[model samples]
Target: MEGQAKGLLKLINEKGIHRNTKFLAIASGKGGVGKTNFAVNLAYILANDFDKKVLLIDADMGMANVHILVNVNTKKTLKDILNGERIEDIIFTTRNFDVLPGFSGIDAINEIDDSAVYKLVQNLNDISENYDFVLIDTSAGIDNKVISFIRASSKTYVLTTPEPTAIMDAYALIKSMKKLYDYSNFKIVVNMVKNEDEGIETFERLRSSIKKFLDIDVQLAGVIPLTKNLQKTVKKKQIISEVYPSDKFVLHLKKIAASEVGEPAPEIKEGFWDRVVSFLRKEG
Candidate 1:
């Protein structure tokens, strides 16, 4: 076992795969928190505003909406890739970034086998290094699928709203994940807030609960205000930073993207791919 571990590490170092791509999984404990919207806009900002190569993978296996919001029509998705299509073949490119769209309303897609998950990661491994950041928009809640993706990411952003239910569910997610995965790198993003104060209060509430029980310190990544324009942009299928560049929400998103929450991309450890493979193996 020791020899095999060393061999795996050696191969990982030699390949140096995914060394330039910083994988960030944008996730939420419950649905309807605008997590997918955040993922899409963040990808656009990173690519257009910061001039970085971004690959936004719509990993919401059950109800994927990234492609819909981005107004990109795709006949093939990550589902096709899972069914033997090359990952490169399924990607749909836009002016902002490349999108690996996921299947929507497909039960089988949601129930992907462990081997298929391994293959999916393996295929992504081939091209992931080409980007500066790979943001995975994950399905809501703390299920096995969600946990698997979050575990593989360099950083996991736990998004939530100010509602008490949302806060509790987000806390529950972190609590559940803490037992099985590393919660140290988890960051909080409070969305749909009236102002920064509300966002901070929500984060503090969730952070206090987590620190009190899990004894894990979670960072406040950013706070997105409740803006009607964001909804309009979603309806129009337009990138917020493009159409409403001067909007407050857009400004906040730009700030978040320019800050450590995004820029000065994190260093990818030499054994990063090895860790991803190990996580998949354990899941399998």
Candidate 2:
């Protein structure tokens, strides 16, 4: 399966590995914020609709679900990579984007060391060089692993809902990450919104809290309204964008892509893996 996945990625990317890949980390303050759902759909749109090569990295560790959302069987995972398997070899190719499935559980996840993190970064950077975009679906909550992934990505998106607890959790995540790197590439996406006005108000509330308390501002990427059809697609293990392209949810996500992800980012001297190494050093 590993070899097959790499071969499939090669077929999609005939030019082989190259630099200039954009790393975008998607996180939720707490679970059930639709973080994985958003990541899967966004990756699908980029690869299937826009005709770009994309890799979706499931960094949720023990609670990986990107494969479940896409209904693909994964015989290998990041655990294999940590045990000396090449990062490129563990990829599980789906219909649209290639998925590097996160491990169900590994003791290392509870006690991962600097060398291990460095190894993951090195291998991820090696394979990520072949794509136009790499979407990291980070684990829920504000653990060290989740924080590390968010801080290392070129862009960070914090997912939230209109619920008060969810809003506070999102603010907490931003505060914790800001203490680490003072990242300016952060954005907010409000999901499961009931209406546009509610979404705007929710974002404004969160933004106000951050500004008044943390003295920093975050951009609102887009709002995804709750739709019954979205759940239907989830049950079917298919991307809502493909099954219901005309949905308001799909339309809003497209707006997010247009915001900045519609094309590859300009090349930079330092790359995603380099950023991870630097972040881990500071984290230590």
Candidate 3:
């Protein structure tokens, strides 16, 4: 199995990475590791630095807080879509990108039945076509909802810190990615690192473990340093990327935006949203 996996990974590399990546999921194995903050800043960098039309979807469900980070007092969400509001009406525009704020009352994802899923999939597809990138800030941990989003997305960037627990949970998340989703191609963002060496070591530790156990492919997207008054900026309800464009962490984000991302230039596996539509149809 390990040999076969290596052969498949070699073939994937020989074919080059897929370029027409439309939906990207930013997720974590545990909360409070700055996953949402990373997603928000990545969207900003992709839009402002790379000139991509980006949409950041706050898909954290019951713990939605992208609005708080961006200082947008949003009133409508997926719930409002059921009340006859168009998805376009619920989107809040920002300086660099757009946001579809998540619903934050209870576990709203459970309340979304097949009909609601169908409605959301349709509206989401319609709106998503206009943008170059759609970043879903998924809820943390190995929750089924998070798995579904990661499964549906074109790319998954698992966020982790240098903390031992974060690394352990990140490996667990990768295991679930392969076990539950039958997916293993993942990009890792080691955030809040003390230095470059620490970041590289952290990624290597996670990678070696994953290679020994999961036999999966994982790429280091980039490393964010523990620089700047990031928490203070977050408290101001502002994105650090925008607030401190010259910060080391923001520069690392820019590096990821430029190197890890590209225009939708190549053909991609189409009908992902349609698959969701079909699932909704079957459920209904």
Write down the TM-score of every candidate: 0.85, 0.86, 0.86
> Higher TM-score: candidate 1 or 3?
3
- Which residues of candidate 3, in runs, are more than 4 Å off? 1-21, 105-115, 263-267, 276-284
Better of 1 and 2 by lDDT: 2
**Winner by lDDT between candidate 3 and candidate 2:** 2
**Candidate 2 structure quality by residue, lDDT tens digits, 102-171:** 8764345446776877787778777877888899998877765556667767788889999999998998
The lDDT leader among the candidates is 2
Q: Considering only N, C-alpha and C atoms within 3 Å, which residue pairs clash in candidate 2? A: none
Candidate 1 residue pairs that clash: none
lDDT of 1 by residue, 1-284 (tens): 99999999888866764356788998888899989888888898888888888899887877888999989888898778678999888998886699999876434533677688678767777778777788999988976454666777778888999999989889888888888775556889889999889999899999898999999989988999888888888888987778888888878878778884445666655534456556555654
- Span of 10 residues, lowest total lDDT, candidate 2: 103-112
